[model samples]
Target: MATKTRVPQTIDAYLAGLEDPTVRKTLGALRTQLRKLLPKATESISYRMPTFKVDGDAVAGFAFFKNHCGYYPFSGSVVPALKSELDGYATSKSGVTFPPDQPLPAKLVKTLVQARLAEIAARGKKPAAAKRKAPVGRPATTGFRVGVVRTLPMTAPELWDWVTTRPERWLGPGATLKAEPGGQYEVPKRRGSPGVRGEVRVVKPGHRLRMTWQPDGWKKPATLQLTVMPKAKGASLHVHMEKLPDAEAREAMRERWSKVLARVA
Candidate 1:
């Protein structure tokens, strides 16, 4: 079998290789937005896509494909909320796509990149400061395990309503949840910022949610399962994340799920 082709270095070189005019133009606009919002970003390609790295780590990236162009916001989870405005475009968990003839929302794109950069800065320092030693033992391999449990003070149906109807109320600042399996859930760039422009993933209500969460370049899809157990007063929520590549990612996912669940509950 032949080897996969490598990605280009600079954003210009990467875009130049695309055969579709629409994908090329959209990527060009994204490039402009990245440079304007993050002056210090170093442009390159990672994972066969154009990536913008900051302080030696990728913050954002974009890709031109046959049917759609992918816009990656490395810090997808922590970006300022923008769920309402994103309705105009087609979006998935990790990125958004603009139709061939449509003009991209340059301003919103800049806001997303900046928000992701800020989020990276907030989380990057923790690993260094903690400096904990790793245990010398065979680690447990529990292939991706994702589940969601019920939150307190709410009946299963009530929590379901909140998740399906008013998701943003608990998910975070300017975030919204959807009820149906294929429905759309959004997180706006910021409170009252107009539009929901974050990850759009599989919404398996009362069961699991499979969504892409990348505010920048690294586009890995993560799935979360929400298990609701009936309690005396309320329901106990157990969230399990699964199918992650390795241990470090699994740990980070645990923390992320815990935080999001805590915010919602």
Candidate 2:
């Protein structure tokens, strides 16, 4: 039988065992930069790595290991313009890593942090006439598109409370959810119509929510996911809808979620 892997319980313990002093120093600098750039961020150990939280939400973090130091932005994507600069390091969908001895690019890191903060701010703003430009190019495409709608009076805690404690308030009215994995969540209506349904495929609190949506009375279904994150100022919410069969479906779902998010502002 296989045994479960034991993980380090604290950031300090994880860092104290590092063999390289230079890596330690570099991570130290990175931590300092994080504090300066995101003053509200707090540090802790999560997933056996150093994690940072903002406004009581995990936003970004760093970890020093044997060969490299990892930097986690937690934001979905950094600004498009920074792609070239980020390429200098090892990057993934949610993070980057730099070699132990590589000189830390403090400014680039700062830029990335600011970009994430801006995204959080935009997410918190009200629906307005002029929209913030979508992240410059096609979002990394996926397999489906899901739409979410909610209306709650504007307040930070109110929005958080509704989303965390009373998800059913909005989702329940038009949809049905089961606690079991692979259970179906059916949305019974479209934006203006009635009697629509969908299926819930994924659910993780304060982390991810995914479901399949079919327009009321439509034959086809699309997938939707919402990823919730805490940022230095407030929260970072990302809506990814996929399996859209056409441009019109994609655009319509985007508009619907964007409008609902504006209400939280």
Predicted structure with the largest lDDT when compared to the true one: 2
lDDT of 1 at 214: 33
True-structure RMSD for candidate 1: 17.2
Q: What overall lDDT goes with each candidate model?
A: 0.57, 0.60
The lowest-lDDT stretch of 10 consecutive residues in candidate 2 is: 144-153
lDDT of 1 by residue, 1-265 (tens): 9998866776778888888877777778778877766677788878778888878888787776667666777644422133444667677656777665665677667545544543443333235434444344643333443232324687766665655566666445666655554555566665433333334354545533444443222355444444443444665455555455556666565566557767666
> Model 2 Cα displacement at 152 (Å)?
34
lDDT of 2: 0.60
Off by over 4 Å in 1: 1-6, 76-81, 124-265
Off by over 4 Å in 2: 1-6, 79-81, 126-265
Q: Please, what are the lDDT tens digits per residue for candidate 2 over residues 87-174? A: 6676776778778888558777765665555445333332443344435565533443333332234344444455545544545454
Total clashing pairs in model 1: 46
- Candidate 1 local distance difference test against the native: 0.57
